[model samples]
Target: EMVMPGDNITMEVELIAPIAMEQGLRFAIREGGRTVGAGVVASIIA
Candidate 1:
């Protein structure tokens, strides 16, 4: 599903990061080989 602008929700995700992520880490949200949006790491669970 597509996330609309101004939406604040918590959901689980998986990523391949070059660096370890912590609170406040930001990343680009990619789809179909292109970036659709951006997001920040709110928490990490592993």
Candidate 2:
């Protein structure tokens, strides 16, 4: 997904366990193997 500087990108993942209680996951958005943006998983329980 292409995101503008101020635009937002949203993602969701489902796991058997609650991700918030366990160690968080790491993710990075990169271009040409150079990181443009990075973040950890945000656990949203619904």
Q: What TM-score against the true fold does each predicted structure earn? A: 0.62, 0.38
lDDT of 2 by residue, 1-45 (tens): 777676766666565675344336677767898988766666645
lDDT of each residue in 1-46, candidate 1, tens digit only = 7678888767798656766779999889778999878888988788
Q: Which stretches of candidate 2 lie over 4 Å from their true place?
A: 1-23, 44-46
lDDT of candidate model 2 versus the reference: 0.65
What TM value does model 1 have?
Answer: 0.62
- The alpha-carbon lDDT assigned to residue 28 of candidate 1 equals 90
**Model 2, backbone clash pairs (residues 3+ apart or across chains), number:** 0
**Residue pairs with clashing backbones, model 2:** none
**lDDT agreement with native, every candidate:** 0.81, 0.65
- Candidate achieving the largest TM-score: 1
Deviation (Å) of 13 in candidate 2: 9.0
Clash count, predicted structure 1: 0
Query: In model 2, which range of ten residues has the least summed lDDT?
Result: 14-23
